[model samples]
Target chain A: MPKAELLDPQGQAVQSAMGRLGFSGVVSVRQGKRFEIEVEGQITEERRIELEHLAETLLANPVIENHTLTIE
Target chain B: MPKAELLDPQGQAVQSAMGRLGFSGVVSVRQGKRFEIEVEGQITEERRIELEHLAETLLANPVIENHTLTIE
Candidate 1:
């Protein structure tokens, strides 16, 4: 998701829409990106490390976003 | 995320880029949208149900995406 301190226009837009639709329980929203990656064969320790590195460097913008990787 | 049977051009593009970047462990990638929502006060059982309804009707595109909600 965008940094906590950053203004998320998209999220704000959704929140506004929700309010218009009468879902008042929602206080705020933050939109984020998700990726489900497939790797052939077993995910060994080395592969896990590589995947984390790739996710940080290529999939997510570290400067503006925080990312997490999970094995199914 | 887009349905598994559906083609995700964005994911395909990313996979191709990964190949070019020499991250061969990646077999495929499926990109999806995420949202972090905050609610004022504690989440009661009724609120949980309402949140689930809201997520299905407003937050996710049920036709092409599946969504899961968790209380973090």
Candidate 2:
């Protein structure tokens, strides 16, 4: 997800359009990215930690985005 | 999320990078968008349906992407 402090232009655009379309129930919106990855084997504790590291370093930009990794 | 039959170049790139970084456990990857929307009231069944409509019409490109709306 994007940093809370940062402005999300795409989200803003969606919110504005919602208002125009009479969807007044929506108060705010923030957009983010999701990745669904398929792994070869079970997600062991060690592998989970490794994937988290990859999510932090490669998948998400720590400077602007905060990410959470879920293995299911 | 992108359609199952469609090619996800971004996911492919990430998968390739994972291989280069020696994270061989990962077999495949799919990329998608997540929108965290704040609504004014509780997500009643009617509101849920409305939001789903918005998600389908505005947030996601039905031609290429599939979407799921979750209200928490």
Provide the TM-score of chain B versus the true chain B for each model in turn.
0.91, 0.93
State chain A's TM-score for model 2: 0.94
Check candidate 2 and list the clashing pairs.
Answer: none
Candidate 1: list runs displaced more than 4 Å: none
Task: Report, to 2 decimal places, the DockQ of model 1.
Answer: 0.75
Error of 2 at A23 (Å): 0.4
Q: lDDT tens digits, residues B1-72, model 2?
A: 999999999999999999999799777899999999999868889878888898899999999998887667
Give per-residue lDDT, candidate 2, residue A25: 71
Q: Which number leads on TM-score?
A: 2
lDDT of each residue in A13-70, candidate 1, tens digit only: 9899888887786778999999888988898899888888988898899999989889
Per-residue lDDT of A72 in model 1: 73
What TM-score would each prediction reach against the true structure? 0.90, 0.96
**Which model scores highest in lDDT?**
2
